[model samples]
Target: PNSSKVQAYVLSRKMLDKIVLLASRAQLPLEAIIPEDDVWGDTAGELGNFLLLQRSARGHFRISAFVEHTIAFHRSIRSVTPPLTGVPSSELQMDSLSLELQRSIDYLSAQLRQVQLHQLKVCCDEE
Candidate 1:
């Protein structure tokens, strides 16, 4: 996987550009634009249990999960409906989030089963 491409896709392009511009003005290295969340967090494995959730309009939401101080998954879903006026209704958003959570759990369970099966096969072969 191309990390540069993944970072560009995951982060907002406009925000990255602004960070680059500021770094240039301050005569700082371009690497300054990258976040340092991993440095201290990795030392103590403090980030392993972190689960960040961001809610957006209607059914839109983003969930980031970290495991063993590494981001295991990051997902964002945007609502398909037309833009709403003012804030989106919380009840509706919760419902959407709940549905998505169940779907994610089911998917994860399926993957875990596959991993267990592979491990079992490997163990049997070794014996």
Candidate 2:
């Protein structure tokens, strides 16, 4: 049976992969869809323990739950070192990323709306 940490890791990776696939279909870069911190966490938390998704500034998303687990595990395993540094601030370039992601989602939504509108028009014309 898989450990809780392992399960969490698998779940997190699967979710991230799905997000990437969806973003690609939408013609958006994975970076634009997922925050750098989250990717970093995936790397740091090799055991697949602990994952979190949160919103950053301007509604941009962040992935940071792995860091906490990593730190805790390290402390338990060995002597703790200085806290890892350089977490991106909630405001760090999030506005731009948010705009990009939002643009992609909005474009897709608009396209769908246009198709629906066209279908309605066609049906009305047929009547």
Candidate 3:
């Protein structure tokens, strides 16, 4: 991601319309559409500076940094399964996750000079 990055949330017009229609039929107010990462970032923001490392699925990890009660830096890392293995070993998974997580922290630090990270949180489903 050496190239300059711009963070944006995109929802397809057709899907958004469908959601709105569904809500209207259900008499539910469709106030806003926020990405899941934004919710996580906002939750973490209450803790001041925070770093979240989450496992979304087997061999998949996501990292998020907060900004304006939303996600500032976010990236998903997928670990490769070792040869002849059905899934990545725990150690291999950790290595990939940590390496990407370090790069994310470094990127956030360089981008935001005052990144005084107050907390580090890790969430993974037990195997």
RMSD of each candidate relative to the true structure:
12.6, 23.3, 4.9
Q: 1 or 3: which has the higher lDDT? A: 3
Q: What's model 3's overall lDDT?
A: 0.69
Best by TM-score: 3
- Judged by lDDT, which candidate is best? 3
Model 3 clashing residue pairs (backbone):
none
After superposition, candidate 2 runs with Cα above 4 Å error: 1-86, 90-92, 114-127
- The C-alpha lDDT values of all candidates are 0.46, 0.36, 0.69
Model 1 TM-score is: 0.48
TM-score of each: 0.48, 0.21, 0.68
Give, for candidate 1, the lowest lDDT window spanning 10 residues. 118-127
Candidate 1 structure quality by residue, lDDT tens digits, 27-115: 98885443433432253343344444444334445554444554445566564232322456556755676676556556645643332
Task: Give candidate 1 misplaced runs (Cα > 4 Å).
Answer: 1-18, 27-30, 35-47, 55-60, 80-90, 112-127
Query: 1-127, model 3: which lDDT tens digit per residue?
Result: 2336676778999999999999999999999998877677667535756788766545556777765554567677655332212465667655776688789888888987765665787775443
